[model samples]
Target chain A: MRHYEDIAVGERVELGSYTVTKAEIREFAEQYDPQPIHVDEAAARESVYGGLIASGWHTAAVCMRLLSEGFLNETASMGSPGLDELRWLAPVRPGDTLSASVEILDTRPSESREDRGYVKNRLVGRNQEGDDVISWEATNIIGRRP
Target chain B: MRHYEDIAVGERVELGSYTVTKAEIREFAEQYDPQPIHVDEAAARESVYGGLIASGWHTAAVCMRLLSEGFLNETASMGSPGLDELRWLAPVRPGDTLSASVEILDTRPSESREDRGYVKNRLVGRNQEGDDVISWEATNIIGRRP
Candidate 1:
């Protein structure tokens, strides 16, 4: 398992991928972002998007899943204070396979706590066509080895 | 329905609330976050949080739900290109009620497209004790009145 000290700045890692589906997008929209463009295919076709699209939040959640499966599970992740930015540059449609790349931008030991440190990462998600779908910068607090 | 022009700058609106539950937290973590502090209760108890806590992404999703239910449903929201920032200030625990307030920070007609406009909002979420738990600034593209 990787601890806080094991992370090196400027290192990049390839996270896994997820293929989005119409059902999952609709279900997620129904619960959290029930906009017409996100939920109703017919209405979406009539809207500006010309068809159904996933919520930006849904794409973010997919990125989170990739991050967890790729690295957070094997590390002493405490939690995150939050994210610096989130940009959905392209529409995510059904059948779009999304993969993520994470770059460790910075790391520092917590001044207020001895057993913990922070690692900042720039996470970028791209579609099968290599078009950028989502990007964000997040800082996670990880435990230091005793 | 609120059109793009209907959104006024500096207007603060109540965006409603959500009550976090342990079951829901674990369910979300299992699917999207899957960290020990978020999914495994026993391991979370031994972690830095001392108990289970909701994932920051989950809290952001809740905020999105509130934003949709409170305002986006009534507006001509095309979708958002991105968000400027996000911060998870405190741990959201089971039974903790989260309420959100949104302030329109800025609004302007889209320069590139005459059919749309841009609205910027600073959204803040607070727990039952009035402690801020999540906060973010988002920019939404809204359709202009035809």
Candidate 2:
């Protein structure tokens, strides 16, 4: 597993892509969001989005899945404190394949703990057409090399 | 349904509550996060949290469910543009009941659209002991009264 000292600022890692399906969108929204625009296709067609669109939270979860598969699983990742500047730039429609990536912005050792550090990164997900669908800044704790 | 003109700045609304179960926590984590601390009880017991904790995203989604049930369903909510300042203040453990609320911070008519406006608010979720677990600021589009 990659440790804190193994990662560098300015390094960009490509998280694997995910193609969102209509069934999955409805399933997620039904349990979490339950908004008409997200769950009911007939109602969504008359709404601003003109059709069913994935909930912003669902889109975020999808990005998280990709991040876990491509990056976090291979790192000495402790966990994340939180995120900032979460923006849903565009609607994610069904069948839209989203590609995600993260750029390491900074890395700092914990002032109180020598065994771990914080790594800040910018995460972005783009649709097949290259339009940004979601983006955020996240801070994660990573263990150091022993 | 409540329109943009019906909402005012500084109005605070209680968004009901939800009790998270251990099964649900692991289920959510299995699909989206799947981190050891969130998924495996044994591994989580040895981690900093000392037990399995719900994924931050899961906590956020629980908040969403409450928000949808208590607030958005009654409003002329067109959609949301985005959000900012998302913070996970504390770990959400199994069987923890979370209560959520939203305080309207500001309201403004759209500069270009006469039919809609923007409502900005702060959303907060607290555990049974009154400790904040998650909070964020969100902006939603609301339709004006005809």
TM values, all candidates: 0.98, 0.97
Q: Model 1 chain A — which ten-residue stretch has the worst lDDT?
A: A76-85
Candidate 1 has a TM-score of 0.98
Stretches of model 2 off by over 4 angstroms after superposition: none
> Just chain B of model 1: what TM-score?
0.98
For the record, the alpha-carbon RMSD of candidate 2 to the native fold, in angstroms, is 1.0
Range of the 10 consecutive residues with the lowest summed lDDT in candidate 2 chain B: B76-85
Chain A superposition TM-score per model: 0.98, 0.99
Worst ten in a row by lDDT for model 2 chain A? A65-74
Going through the candidates in order, the fraction of native interface contacts each one reproduces equals 0.90, 0.76
**Segments of candidate 1 deviating more than 4 angstroms:** none
